[model samples]
Target: MSVINYGQLLQLAWPEIILTVAALIALAADLLFFRQSALRTRFLVAASIASIGCIAAIFKLLPGSSEGMLLGGVFLSNPATHLVQIALLVIAILTLFLSVDSTFTDHVGEFVLLILLATTGMMFLVASQDLLVIFISLELLSLSVYILAGFDKRSSRSAEAALKYFLFGGMSAAFMLFGFSLLYGFSNSTNLVQIASAIHAVPLNPLVILAIVTTVIGFGFKIAAAPFHFWAPDVYQGAPTPSAAFIASGSKVASFFIFFQVLVIGFAGAEGSATLHHFQSGWVPVIVTVAVASMLLGNLVAITQTSLRRLLAYSAVAHAGYMLLAYVAHSEQSLAALLYYVATYALATLGIFGILTVTEKQLGNDKISDLAGLSRRAPFLSACLFIFVLSLAGIPPLSGFFAKFLLFTAVLAVSPGSKLLIGLIIFAIGMSAVSLYYYLRVLKSAFVADPPADATPIQSPMLLQLVVGLLAAGVVALGCAPDLILNQILKVIHASGL
Candidate 1:
């Protein structure tokens, strides 16, 4: 066995280390201020410290040249991983921003600390190249999120969300662990690179197929894909809005990153090998079926939703389908598209949730109808909401449109002559069109519908407004000039030699 190199490992893992230290510091600060009368000030201090830590972590992550495998090849530092770490950190910072004056502000230090821990987990998760590392990192992320989901002790809905999430998440973890065990049984290894090499030498077996399907299903739950997405709407509706945003945006980015890594690396076989062909044949069909179901079901179900949070939850399911298109294609370009799409999706979704949080605070509910006459009362907020909603619907001149366009284009590029892929593209287009109706429904409530007699202007904190405005601008910028980010993603992919 190769000896571990401590110095190199530290360099590769600096971001995670910084984040962990930051979380501990935040926790200590929380304890220190537990009895303080200046509750809001304590929360602000914790948030500020966490934000500084996140910024520091980003800097640490940015210095690398996307080279090196650390800790005996269990962790990798590449351009793709760096980019994902940056996105996760940004999402954490945004979550911190939303936490101020929100539901969990009373427990702000714990909130910031949990976000930091989750961010740390995701950083490790995206960089992980071994099953053991993957499982541990995933748990770190999930456990933090579970607590954050139920942080509001006074709300039974929050408790229910946590319980359901925990139960479902536990089952998924079991399935994934069993599947990983199967993989180890076949390959005698947990390291993905070694597994790929080993699988190339082993005969394809029934257990291999089972492992692939089960593992995908496990990840399917993580990404909120259809048939495994039952836990999302309730959790999003019940959890504090910032927690929901973290789960939806930050968690998703990390999940997809790891999923892509596992698929592209672990089961990949030598060219022309039976194992490669068998793996693809076994997994692609399953992915395509899930994608089709997710798109159709998510879009169709979202139309009937009255609560804005639930609507976004279902919409997230559909977006997962769109991202799954990248897996089906399984090429470097497709992976780039996936990364680009999720980044844009996270921006819009987080912006929407931030606005929703403010609205919920002022109106005491997140019903779509509550946004009526928002244009008259808070034009800036309403307009920002309109932009985010339109982006989500894949409307022209918005980031979501370009995201879908790139995804579909990558799909077509991989198999231009395949009639089945063409049909899938068409179906995806139809679903996008269907999604517009619901998105527009919300926009109509915000912009066109008359306010009730008691309607009053929303008084969002300036920080919230700044956060949403920046996200809105990011959505528009990514829409209009996607290459600004896409170019960087392609560079990362190229550097990784994918």
Candidate 2:
């Protein structure tokens, strides 16, 4: 066993420590100094502090930060993990920016504190290579998010969402813990590499298969994949906009990153083929099955939704399916593809939710019809929405398009002439087309439909508008220059020898 190095661990964990300090400071400032301040003023101060802390964390991770393992592999630091941690911080910052004008909760300090805490959990989550660390980090993250979901105490829907999320999360955690215990019993180690070595040496057994299934169940709920995704639509619709945004963005990056690691690293030799008619009994086949269900159910059901958040929830499920395709490939290129796709997809989804935050505040609803004549009332926001929605629908010259292209190409590259994968790609393409219909319904409401006679222009805060615009611009820039982010991801993957 490796000796625990307290000093080295602290050196590697400075970024998370910074964020925790910032969370406490934000909470204290809100309770003591800003309790009587205006909601907007309180939000501004807390958000500024949080943003600055996130910036500090990002700087800590810049190019030359320490990289090593600690606590017998309970903690890990590597270029790839640092890259993901940076992305999580960036998403948290953006979520904070979008929350500055929120009125759902007056407890600005607590809200921001929870966000920071959740982000800290995510940072720890992506930096670990041990099952014990992973489970603990996930619980920390999940607890914080459950509170955030119901932060709007005035709304019963918010409370209900929180209750449902907590219940489902508890069950998933139990399942994941059981799976981890089985893995520990099998390998006598919590370290993923050692677990992989053990798995490689033994024949695939019933207990190993059970562990894989239970582990998948746990992560499936996290990523909002179908069958295990019953909690997502409600949570997305009932939770406060900022909470949903964080769940969809930062939480997703962390969850998917760890999921990839657990499968590709911990279950290395057990990846049975997922190719059509050639399916082997491994994690890949399980993921492929989930992917198919998510794509079909998410797209087909989204077409019937009128609520914008619900539609996006279903869309997220579908996008999760697309993202899962990378796992089917399970190569370094697939890792890069998955990261780029999830990052870009998260940006687009967050931008859409940001638009909802503004429009819902002004119009009093997030129904598709609430956006009627949005172009006439809020042209800039509408234009931003155009970019965001189109990007999400995988329209050309947008980040979503390139993300899908890279992912599909990577999967195809994995098996040069596999008919099953080809068919899956074709089905995914069809679902993308199906997705365009619902997305256009949103655009049609914003651009083509006539406004209510009493409608007035949406008066979004300038800062909020700017943040949303920046997010839309990011989607566009990434799409137009896919290599910009993809190259960075590839560099980290290579540097870590992933």
Clashes of each: 0, 0
lDDT of 2 by residue, 215-315 (tens): 99999999999988888999999999999999989999999989999999999998887665666677888999999999999999999999999999999
Measured by lDDT, the strongest candidate is: 2
List the lowest-lDDT window of 10 residues for candidate 1: 270-279
Residue 172, candidate 2: Cα error in Å is 1.0
Query: Residue 324 of model 1: what lDDT?
Result: 93
Model 1 per-residue lDDT tens digits across residues 67-182: 59865458888887888889899989988887776745476677888889888888889988899999999999999999988988888999999999999999999999999999
TM-score of each: 0.96, 0.98
Q: Work out how many backbone clashes candidate 2 has.
A: 0
Provide C-alpha RMSD values for all models, in order: 2.5, 1.1
Task: Kindly report which residue stretches of model 1 are placed more than 4 angstroms away from their true locations once superposed.
Answer: 33-37, 63-66, 200-203, 270-280
Evaluate model 1: give its lDDT.
0.86
lDDT of 1 at 366: 94
